[model samples]
Target: MAFDIYDFTSLTSSIHEGLATFLPPVGVLIAEWLLVGISVLLFVAVFGLILVYLERKVCALFQQRLGPMRVGKWGLLQTIADFIKLLMKELITPNKADKFLYNLAPFIVIIVTFMAIAAIPFAKGLQAIDFDIGVLYVSSVSSLGVIGVLLAGWSSNNKYSLIGAMRSGAQIISYELSVGMSLITMIILAGSMQISEIIQAQSTGWFIFTGHIPAVIAFIVFLIAGTAETNRGPFDLAEAESELTAGFHTEYSGIKFAFFFLAEYVNLFIVSAMATVLFLGGWMPFHVGSLDGFNAVMDFIPPIFWFFGKVMFVIFLIMWFKWTFPRLRIDQILTLEWKYLLPVNLLNILLMTLIVLMGWHF
Candidate 1:
């Protein structure tokens, strides 16, 4: 059967009914729990693999090269090979490092990333958890990633690692303001924080289109903030190889290092997906105003395709920033955030509020 967002609620009601028919209620409950847990685990594992491969290919295409060509046709097996390599490699800890924290940091980062995926609506009625505070939940859960980075950096006891952690912490805090404000504008327009409701609000037209000028401004700010939040591209001073020598997890090796790397890419996917959901309309077909045929043609494509297409488009823009721009110095990075983005984003939010109040949106 296809994934159903309402399955958990339905399952709960079913369990109650099952109790009336069966003598051993405990067994049925246990079985259902196991099934749900296993399904979530499998979904995460598969999604992680596919996302990694897709990112590689996307990056490759932008750089005028083939990403993966050997393992599976067009290098599809590259990530699998990388996974095996990580698994086979020996885990190493520095002599002076806090062994416990060093090993735990990666898992913490991965856990936070995986948790945020639960609220993402893959398609109509396909979300894992449909909470009222879905947007806020995502923002809160994502911020926890910086903790893991800091732990890894501090525990490693390397100067570069420490600097990387500091930079990451600062960057995340700075960008989070703009990202949150951008999301706030969407929430204000939608009049709800639920991911499903947000998507529904875009049924008539995506927020990017409806909110018009202010929405476009917020979108750009969000994109920039998100890129920095994920520690990608020009804002990736935390991992600047020429400066920090691999950044926060510099001393980590084998599976430990792999965890940090995985977390980074996973965060990238999350940010892109969030952008798709908030501005481009998650799982909603594109519609040109008053173009019935075009809208119908768009609807023929599955919601998931629209969702992924928008995400990939955002990802391409991110990769473009990465390849085209030079890395900003740490001081310059802070200055850009406080001096430019913060002020512009604050003004954008005010303008958005005015636009919404004036009913200027189409």
Candidate 2:
């Protein structure tokens, strides 16, 4: 039988039927859930390693230095080595630390990331969960990571950790408004929050191109705010090494530390994937108007590749911000969100509303 790579739902349905052939209904359901959980976990682990390697190389390129060249053929195994090292390290809890919350913090952070990942559409029918309000779901779910960060800091009983976590809370809280406003702007233009429907709406052209200036503004704002939301560099005041000595997770070690580390990269992926879906048209091939021949060629490249290509491009842009810019002081970070991004985002939303109402957007 010829395989149709584009029809992910068919593949998943076949698996469901196969499971049901022998197992009872409840057993099938449990089996499917277990499979999904395992698949997502594996994807997270592998993707985290790839992102770490990618970041190292990206940072090296920006600084004109070679990175991780000695480990397994262009340093392909460097991340794996690091993972093993982290696994073997000691898990230490300070005597004064609040043991329960301290241990639970990293799990909360990582689990939140996994939950957000479930909503993202990697390719056609490849999404884990297709909520009617996917945009709202992702935005709301991703913001909960701050609770874990706060817990890690307060429970650690370390002053520097507490200060760092406080900065993170303030940073995420301030930028989250901009992130929501930017998404709201696009949600206005798109008219529906369903991820698949939004992609289908872009069959003519991506929102970034068709919605023009307002769409462009929202995309830019989303990128900026998303970076802050992920607690990435420049906005990474949460883990500002120079100021707070490893920040909120300072007291965590071994796999606990690895959980915090892996969550960071996976969150970065989620942000990039969200940007791709909202602006670039998730899994949609690039098509130039009135150019059927060119578009047909693009269609041959496969939707999954198109999705990942756009995701990687956005990831590169975020990484560029990290390597090119100086880390902002916490005050400056808050000021950028409150004094600048928030006001512009408000006006942008209003403009988008007008555009949608007037049918000004193509």
Task: List the global CA lDDT of all models.
Answer: 0.84, 0.92
- In model 1, pairs of residues that clash are 5-125, 68-74, 68-75, 69-75
Cα lDDT tens digits, model 2, 187-304, are 8877899999989889889999989999999999999999999999988888989988999999899999999999999999999999999999989999999899999999998799
> Where is model 2 more than 4 Å wrong at Cα?
none
The TM-scores, one per candidate, come to 0.90, 0.98
Q: Compute the lDDT of residue 313 as modeled in candidate 2.
A: 99
Ten consecutive residues with minimal summed lDDT in candidate 2?
1-10
Query: Model 1, which residues run further than 4 Å from truth?
Result: 1-37
What overall lDDT, based on C-alpha atoms, would model 1 receive against the true structure?
Answer: 0.84
Worst 10 residues of 1 by lDDT: 1-10
Q: Once model 2 is optimally superposed onto the true structure by TM-score, how far is the C-alpha of residue 280 displaced, in angstroms?
A: 0.6
